[model samples]
Target chain A: MHTAGVTLQQVAQQAGVSLATASRVLHGSGSRTVGEELRRRVEAAAQELRYVSNAPAQALARATSDVVGLIVHDVADPYFGAIAAGAMRAAREQRLMVMIAATFREPGLELEYLRSLRAQRARAVILAGSGTADADATARLAEEIAGFEADGGRVVCVGERGPDLDTVVMANRGGGGLAARGLWDLGHRRIGVVSGPAELLTVRHRLDGARRALRSLGAPLAPDAVTVGDFTREGGRVAAVRLLRARPDLTAVLVLNDVMAAGALAGLRDDLGLAVPDRVSVVGFDDVPFAADLRPALSTVRLPLEAAGEAAVRLLLEPSGDEPRRVALAAELVLRDSTATTVG
Target chain B: MHTAGVTLQQVAQQAGVSLATASRVLHGSGSRTVGEELRRRVEAAAQELRYVSNAPAQALARATSDVVGLIVHDVADPYFGAIAAGAMRAAREQRLMVMIAATFREPGLELEYLRSLRAQRARAVILAGSGTADADATARLAEEIAGFEADGGRVVCVGERGPDLDTVVMANRGGGGLAARGLWDLGHRRIGVVSGPAELLTVRHRLDGARRALRSLGAPLAPDAVTVGDFTREGGRVAAVRLLRARPDLTAVLVLNDVMAAGALAGLRDDLGLAVPDRVSVVGFDDVPFAADLRPALSTVRLPLEAAGEAAVRLLLEPSGDEPRRVALAAELVLRDSTATTVG
Candidate 1:
């Protein structure tokens, strides 16, 4: 029999043995007692046929491994770090080991890790990052995840929803609107925005929400008021500099993430020689660990990052029905010293 | 043939086969083939006497896996996060996947992870944090690592040296001295120190260095001037508060780490209502990513954390003789706005 199309049933048939006996012999499970002669015949048939079972069948044959896989865009980023920490804590409680892989924001790498985790026979796999803007990458990921699930692997996402997978999503749009409203309430009419990559769903949702808030306040944000950069600190710095140069009249600058906000703070002070709140107020999203410790202390939106991670793991570990599980978390606007009443 | 104490040579002799043929048949290496009858005889003899192979022997029999293991103290800590990022980057370039496990500062967990990695047959294992204070933990780690190495697996340590393993040592003591001297040069004599867990080698090295600096300057650190905490932000806050309450006459405070320094700054401002520099200067070690952006901009000792991580991976990947490799990195003192000359 050709190995490419060989099956366990065919091997069992050739060996003149039952499927269970064949499986027990092939999987090296010693619990069943098969006569030496019969076991040898089954093994010989399997070797001749070169049978290869799918991941699920192979997993069932072996002792189930107690390892869970976690994939993040960047583990060094405090945002993802906080989430991974929570997942690690939960895994420890359940006596499960976590094997984390960093994709570094590359969608291709994410898919590669999923395949690797499947090969490792991990009990579950959690992808923790923003959904990519690449349609092909997204489609491939969806297909891969579907195949993985079919093979008895559980998967959960901790950031934006991806192709109907179980997800714990943050309220990016609402948080953006809340941030804008908070700045507007501080008497800041003229504001600028430091946005992340245009292709990212996070940037789009947040920007849309900010625009909605501006419209509701009867002071819509202009096209010229927005500058985009990578969702990173250096990107934030460059965008902030561009924003200051483009519109010096802006009283406050809203950053999409806390890491970027830190960069903007540096840009305002080092590059523009501008005083925070006095010259240009600053606000950020995602109240990361260091946000409260920043010099002026950041005024931002707080997301339950750790809790989101724990929830994602819980969704994976719990039994699921047909419908994909969805858990949406709310973001709260936290007022700090980074924003102040507009100076006349 | 009795499987116990039955070496492969003895099995080959009993089966009337060459040692090479016995190995090829036993390992199931398809490159070379033997007669079906001969293979059956070898199999029967092996099954009649159960034999167990070492990890390397089992690994060699199977296709080599493409995964490297990284063990960290905590993924949530920025210091470890930065190192993990660098290692992840390097692993990507090599087309090898990284499997990260966080011990959460538990030595027993660290040992458990080592065993897990060995079971996975990882290409290499990197332990990326401080060694435990427990002597037994250290001894067990050394034994495990030695066994792993004996089984043809490579191991590297990234923070403090663990046993005689290859290590990338940070200049914790020298950095501590640098931080203290920086404060001393600023005309502050009466100083207080916020230390991490006293049992940690890092804490001991840094504190000893700071004491050395104080003594060299003809001003010894008073026994009452030191307060120990968990090497965390909250611990820093509590330690800072205790230090201030105990040593009200102090003019400057040196925190062992930047994360803790951020807490000390908060404590000085919120708990004591004291003006930084004018009332009490502050300095710290390990200029993490947010150090330069902290409100007053942290004055700290900058360790090349990412570079250290990269170096650790390089050491593991590169071939070395029986002698262990050692790489020591320097720390630079960064003077920022947080520290100033004390007022009369």
Candidate 2:
């Protein structure tokens, strides 16, 4: 109003295109895919004019929240934080917002919140909660997400998408296999396991990989060697205790998460009085912010949590030609001071 | 309707009163404060017939957005999750809703979001982010909040209100002093400190308290004893290294946060190769979920984040009358396995 004079219509006139065409090119409208030539022209014109679009009107016209629902089991978990960062970046790319819903590991509350989410007219829903105690509970959650889709809502479930739902998941089994191979490479035979909730699909996949690795070494998993926890620090402490009690001769422990791994470390040092790496080695999943900050620099599986979030939002908002997206992000092993070679 | 038929006006008529009086009496509108005879007649009539009032008309007459604003620094921080839970509970009690505005630790973004927050016709704004990096910034934020109040919106800033704010804060300084005194009583000397952002009032207050304790001990803070960080795990590690380098002869380190404390432990062990408790001891603030789960469990000053959120809401919704309401939550030091006596 004061100095710089420019608008989308002006840009459209300069670009020899309609206002809608200009908007499609400028706004990167998710409703339709823009061709390369028009997009480049619109971008150049908008840049020349320094055109700025009002988000509110565009959002109102969409009659949608411009918010993607990111449902996770626990907001406090550092693992989920990575996923959230990814989703936020992707959502921001489309000028969409990300709304987080933490169910606190309760399936019933999650179901109740899903109803409320429906009322918000959310652009899409990304279901990612996995650490549940029962398979039927997750199956029911999947049913609800399926119903949400049936009602013409968009959804992208991670890890375990039901048959009727569209999803973008990681190669969890492969990630687990990688972890197992890393453990095997460390010459860890009598290894103890600290697992996440039994109901979670990732736990099953990771467990399968662990079993496969053990079988490859011609070593059977000792009875009661694997202990399951709720994927919390307290759970990790309790599970570590159980594992150590059952397999005192174990030289290494693999925990499902960094938080629980931190817990297991405390329990081993304080309760069991074991020297890290010298007496026993500890490996954890989910390379959280504090993983490197830990004394032993938790040698764990690093999953692209943030990328998953971003990809989930993109997959939900922009529907590409009918191939159901099964985008599996990469995972890598970060070696640290936690694991020690078995000493004679 | 085959129900107990007893007119409330009958009781009023028998008592020689009008319908309005009968209605008031039967509803027990002023039963406790009004005349005893009127109250008795109202109670008797209400017992005879359960005549419900016209709630629909009252509801029709009322118009409100039934929404509040939750302004937070960053959703990435786990501490905010508990606070959110508390505020949500209070919102449910008040029959209103909340929308979270994530500031991402920027004052300009916070200001921009506040404008949108105001336009949403929010009944109140809950301020949960005070980065403490800029007093002037917070003051400006307070002024903006005051402006919002002038425009008929209520504001409640969490963690302590300044002269221009209505704050529900905690005894952060007192907690810090207590932590310092505990270390002193345990006979630990040559302590290193990890402080929060210098600009934050809460961080400054804690720093002042620690200084006060050191002053009481008739000792001066070593030039290299204290390091400031941004309150992240990475920040903690950076600060811890400085503290250790400055005071290699030091035995104890007090960090401002648990995440930082975890980082401090990593630096102490990985960088300095010091055995915890025997060669070094560490304490942190904020007993977050995983605080106690860490190896050599974090000894921290616990600030009830959730309770403060609930208290803040309660303060904002209710009137304080002649008294200026400033709710101060108490912070307590949780002793755990992390700290130990400095030994040669």
Candidate 3:
């Protein structure tokens, strides 16, 4: 009655040992040990029978499985892809298989996935999605997380979600400041901002930092100078066009992320017929892969994406103390060919 | 007694129903039905007790699981990311969780991941990595696939692996032909080929297709004109440098992939101080997301990567017949600004 090839019962019968002894020798958790002769017999019998160990049964015998769940907003996005790769690398070292689900920026889907991971008895879950500003959704998510933790599953969020949860926080606001200040130092006075959805905490923090930095430099960013995109390349392009059309006096624009920055670069040259650095300088955040491949290359704030993912996984595996743990990652601005002194 | 919160037995007791009735009601495979009154009581008791269903136990009872495995060479690569996004989209529709493993191009790691997925009794596995030319490794992989299928697990390969298995084959050779013809039509006769590892079947097929296409045009590709890279941007840059130093007469180069083509562009302009499409022309395969954002854009062959991923998942969910299923995808040439006519 084995759906997974030969069963352990057959192996035990062939080896002439008790079922407990056969299991102890084959898939034991290392706390128990079997005699060498018995273990050899069991292993040989397993090979002869071509037996495949049932992980479900083993997981039932223990309390949990080797699987860890990783939830992201979009796996196809290079930001999430880099993080998943790093998380997978760390999971490999822990001998844990990672099950990933893309929520596509839907808060409902994120909650559903957490419940599913909890049901699967996943050892831990890494929440790599951005925090939504919806209070109701956040409260519901916090409750669901409590349920998951109650069931012995650990969770580590990659960004700011809520209080009392382990998190690997990126210096998003600081990065925004760096992007603005870099442009300011290049003699760019009238600078515009291209941002993503205001509902995202990341977007809010980054915009706040840019506005503050610009205000201190005596060129306060006007509300009309900021245009919102959907955090996509196309959205960035559309927003850049709208912003530049309205504020023709601006000499530079600060994009919230690299993807949008790439779009702004295209819009500035192809749409508006303006040369970069000579007509308009651009700065972007997140310095994702291929940032340097763009025309004139991109000057962006470097966020250690892979390291953030690795840190989240590490926090999940570490022992929990009385308080939630936080790992702060710093963002640095990298100057490239995209930015230059603004010429009149 | 209940590691995952309240157990089914406790719910059964609270609902005043038989253990069998509780099992048939909650987490049932839908083959049996319980009385409406009993189902209501069970639902109420489950909510009150905060019972979390055990997926492992459910999998054991059903002899299968709702989890599918996806194996890739690298997840950080945008090519794989696009595919994964498609696969995840399809999996979400099917209400299945996908566990992804990156083998990092290691044959041993691929095999190990396969066994792990099998042990977990995953519903199916999608092999998205390129096939290796190693005979021993292929044989071993085939044997493992045989064992996995025998245990009631479905296997679907994304690209060419071996015979007698379902696959969603991308037109690698045809794509290569398209790239070569696109360049030939532009009057580039003295052409060079930049490629990845020769051990990959994809690389071999692509190179063969280009060689055949060029041969038909009476400009046969010479062995000395082809350079091998590690399928990375840096590798492509170094290979382009070496090729130009050796064969200065070549007016164009066909890069195997877009990532490498990006590097070749940088090398041609920065290292060699040559103008694109003026002093040299270049063509790449796989019109990835950032192809258009690159300077002068990239002329390449477009492969429907996301559709390929969706098709694999669809194949896995469909019932298997006597004959193995195959889905062939066509690759088309996309002309951008990267290539131009050869000038003296």
Candidate with top lDDT is: 3
Cα lDDT of model 3 by residue, B1-344, tens digit: 12756689999999999888988888776889999999999989988997888888878877889999999988888888888989999999999999999998898999999999999999999999688899999999999999999888899998889779899999999998888988888888889999989988888888888999999989999888999998888888888888887898899999998889999999988999878878888888889899999988999889999999999999999866679999999999998888888753
Chain B alone: TM-score in each candidate?
A: 0.81, 0.79, 0.96
Global local distance difference test of model 1: 0.82
lDDT of 2 at A75: 55
lDDT of 2 by residue, B156-232 (tens): 88875564467887777888787888787777878778987887777777877877888788765675788898777
Report the backbone clash tally of model 1: 1
Candidate 1 per-residue lDDT, tens place, B273-317, comes to 888867888888888898888878888889888888788788877
Q: What is the lDDT of residue A275 in candidate 3?
A: 92
- Could you tell me which 10 consecutive residues in candidate 3 chain B have the lowest summed lDDT? B1-10
Worst 10 residues of 2 chain B by lDDT: B55-64
Candidate 3 global TM-score: 0.97
Q: What lDDT does candidate 2 reach at residue B156?
A: 82
| Top-TM-score candidate index | 3
After superposition, candidate 1 runs with Cα above 4 Å error: A1-64, B1-60, B342-344
DockQ, in order, for the candidates? 0.18, 0.07, 0.68
Error of 3 at A43 (Å): 2.4
Give the distance in Å from residue B189's predicted Cα in candidate 3 to where it truly belongs: 1.4
Ranking by DockQ: 3, 1, 2
Lowest-scoring 10 consecutive residues by lDDT in candidate 3 chain A? Answer: A1-10
